[model samples]
Target: MTETTPAQLIARSNRLGADPKNTNYAGGNTSAKGTEIDPVTGTPVELLWVKGSGGDLGTLQESGLAVLRLDRMRALVDVYPGLEREDEMVAAFDYCLHGKGGAAPSIDTAMHGLVDAAHVDHLHPDSGIAIATAVDGEALTSRIFGDKVVWVPWRRPGFQLGLDIAQIKAANPQAVGCILGGHGITAWGETSEESEANSLWIIDTAQAYIDEHGVDEPFGAVRPGYEPLPVDARLERAAALAPTIRGIASTDSPMVGHFTDSEEVLEFLASEKAPALAALGTSCPDHFLRTKVKPLILDLPATASVEEQIARLHELHAEYRADYQAYYEAHATAESPAIRGADPLIVLIPGVGMFSYGANKQTARVAGEFYVNAINVMRGAEALSSYQPISDAEKFRIEYWALEEAKLQRMPKPKSHQGRIAFVTGAASGIGKAIATRLAAEGACVIVADLDLEKAAAAAAELGGPDVAVGVAANVADAAAVQQALNDAVLSFGGVDLVVNNAGLSLSKPLLETTEQDWDLQHDVMAKGSFLVSKAAAKVLIEQRLGGDIVYISSKNSVFAGPNNIAYSATKADQAHQVRLLAVELGEHGIRVNGINPDGVVRGSGIFASGWGANRAATYGVKEEDLGQFYANRTILKREVVPENVADAVYVLTGPELSRTTGLHIPVDSGVAAAFLR
Candidate 1:
């Protein structure tokens, strides 16, 4: 065994994945260290680190590792001899994974300790996964590797896997390391040189076997699932998992194009009548944190609801967790707690795969690099044989490890929205301002549109710098002006997925005293403006083939019909009526329509100030300050209807949290029951 040179390491690392560009989740993790850098807060995290669970080990680093006290680990193992209860096992692993005890070893620590050698490395390399999990994996693998590496039956990782390897070691005290059946390979050496060489040789041989069989490339990888998070912070989260550098994320990060399966795979799937399932981040032992327990397979067509999708993902995770819990309950001591919260089941979205966080630049680069290559390998070998994963029972034991759960808890950023956009009409102040600010905070590029150009400009300035929020000047009621804003949105940010239509004016007058001019003034801005904005969104959303979300700022008076405000009430209904029809027409195009029926907004700082509210209260025998609050607190929930309430509703509509319901109007009237309590 010889020593590996740095140049040799770098060259090998570059070849570890596709999109060797220093980006997270582009294709997969890079094996290179220290390439990711934080774009915001301008702080640098680790550059090189060990890859997460089942990550492309080809792109690994020392910092990414969950360094643990090996002595402490052995102590925990002794206490729980059976370690069978899934929850108990998970609790143990989570506690240990945090390795907060100065030596937080990886969840795979035990296996690394057992099967690993002077230089030990394991990976669920794409090529190996395909042949190993196939119908004829045993025969195919046997035919390819011949006598180079020994093969054993599939077994769960940890003590049992360690035992299996130990047995193999026992039989041939001097024999080379063995590969786990239906899983991945572990290359060990007397020295790092021998280990890396063995690993490369196995990878090459596996690639040759796959190429000979003419398997197609990995197809239909869709990362559609998104969790809302801060844009700059998301970039920072990406940076932390790296070895040395940081990452500069953009609005474009969420705009990755979708990829469907090839004709061959599509045909195969249709004929079999089975929904397509993806093997997440290498499967089994790597299943817990990085890619979760399962990948988000779209079941051939797209899953309908975001909530439903989230439900399905959680259900799958719950099933895996339950099965784990049952196993431990049945087999081990009853005192252990479940490790890692339910949140740790981080499933990779079908279209949007897993991302990276490393200690140094090299580590992050390598993690992304490795995933890109591994995914390709998984796809390429599909035609040759199916990549069936290890049984769930075995997967639970490894996943529930206390050490692994601990590592997950410390993840810098666990949620993000990658491919969505938002717009806020009258985004200069109050409700509109709040809505735009919230969406931008959660990683959506907000187009702050207002007729008052100066106000919009000032609002954008407050958001600081370019990208998070951009001010657009246009009158929502004017067809041409509305269109120019739409065009600007398309050109500047690809397309819009979210719009909070908050541009409107309010007035107070008795119904008998109302005239044509006051009525038109209200209708032109609120009702017509809402329709024009929706109209523009429909065309762009349909063209882009991406779904859209629209949030109308309808007033609570639309339903409640408060005293002395007939025109405001009428226009609010008109604006909301447009949303229902809009839903019918745009549903097929993937656009959702929703509205917020906000009540008595006292901070009415948009186009029209709350001067109307103050005057109305004086005329109605109440204090100006008490009118808004008085009306709001009369509700069942007894909460004040503030700008924040309206803003929250808009935020929910424009994000993945409410991606399922369209054409639905939510009342931000502090939970007032629609009917009176007689």
Candidate 2:
């Protein structure tokens, strides 16, 4: 066989990882053993290049591979101190690294290094795990593959497990792989292509076996009352319950949530066997690490009203937390890491579907995907025999493993507004766009709400696509539109914690020239609009019980008594007062209401470009293009106030720096002395 290179290994890994049916996101490891010239010794040396910790194989790169000298790696066996000291071996891997060591070695490094194969693949394919976790897995393996695949008993992943697998491989030369008891599967070959083919063969063969002999209903009959709700009703209920679920899940720390109602999830949730099997928990270490020991299955039936379900959710959440605390106390030893969190990462509702929470959107989404994989494992295992998994004590050991805690510790500090969701009206352009960009950069997911759907979507794309930002058309003057925008926010990002009321237009006209139509138009867009948006958002904030921020973009004219601006000025003044009123009223709920007062923001502003600048310039007797400089000259600081200046104030008001400062109006008018707050 031709020797495999690192590049070929990467290609092979990508192919295997691309299909969800083969393995889950970041759930497996692949390795290639090759020879390299030693820089100092000027001689050939063997090296093991394996996928590193926290990397997804589908997107693996050269930088993601940890290169270790095989000679040094194998030397650890001489000093092996038995099962009790297996964890210390992970730390010792640093000494075996080749050169700068591309990426951090993972717990599975020993498995790759100890096994005598030129190429190796360890994966958690749903089909492979089914046979591995079945009650009669050993007999099933013997009957299905004969001597082609071996079976190894359950063992926690460490150096000792590596030794066991190595011994099994040596004893059975005909075997291409082994079904890791209560875990996953491991396959290897003399070349990358062979190894990949072997892995696929094992997965396919096991799946075929299950297909031929499996029972008709693996998860048992669907409970009559637990059948999936109608499509519209399911979504409506999911939206209503998301904020409350996200709230309880984030009791310890803020989290972004993802909801799914796929066929697999709905089928399992509606099954009579779901509750008992869910309590048994996931078998794969990768599965439980992201999903927690088990999900919080909503006890109420699908036929229950949404209101009743919500009420029962609160009680279930309390009980879940208590049960989690007990689980921690039952298994914690003096050497174990502190309890990470009591909140269940995955929450399952019989008909409403599942909601998963994490520190960010991708993590939350991937956790849900992993739980689906778990559901598949459960389905297949039950079909083959009974779905047996690792014991609670073993699960506790891996969950609180010191090595896992160290990985958590090494993670970089989170950005300022991490896990926050912001809804910005008029975000398609000008100050609103600037605010959205800034907030997203600080780790807040943004909902760009504007009257122009195309522009809002374009700006959302520029900010970072659906993950970080999404666009919704909203005429804030219309209360229904405002409500719909908030609903979109809830659906897109679970809920809104920050709202920027910045949608408005101005008409530079005197008292006689300012018709009644002008007054109504300006007031409706700014004064009434801010109130409508705030009112709609408050319901979600109160429901979440997570506390929130509402910031109004007023103007210097709000207090400075600018000339020929009666309607615009009146609306601005009304908006400024709304900040104070809402701040006082929402204070008990920990919702801070604030405002930013800025002078002419002429550059790149949609309002200014839409003829408002020319009108203001004509009113002030200055060239239209010079209106920005004209306004700047009048400020005490002589600085041109741009949209970014207003955006900066919004960030500060909603950020932790001003967490306690509510009902505050920050003047971003380049130091307009007359507009200064008293």
Highest-scoring model, lDDT = 2
TM-scores, each model vs. reference: 0.47, 0.98
Q: Model 1: per-residue lDDT, tens digit, 445-503?
A: 66789998888878877875344556889798899899778765643444567777888
lDDT of each candidate versus the true structure: 0.55, 0.92
Measured with C-alpha atoms, the lDDT of residue 652 in candidate 2 is 87
User: What would the TM-score be for candidate 2 when compared with the true structure?
Assistant: 0.98
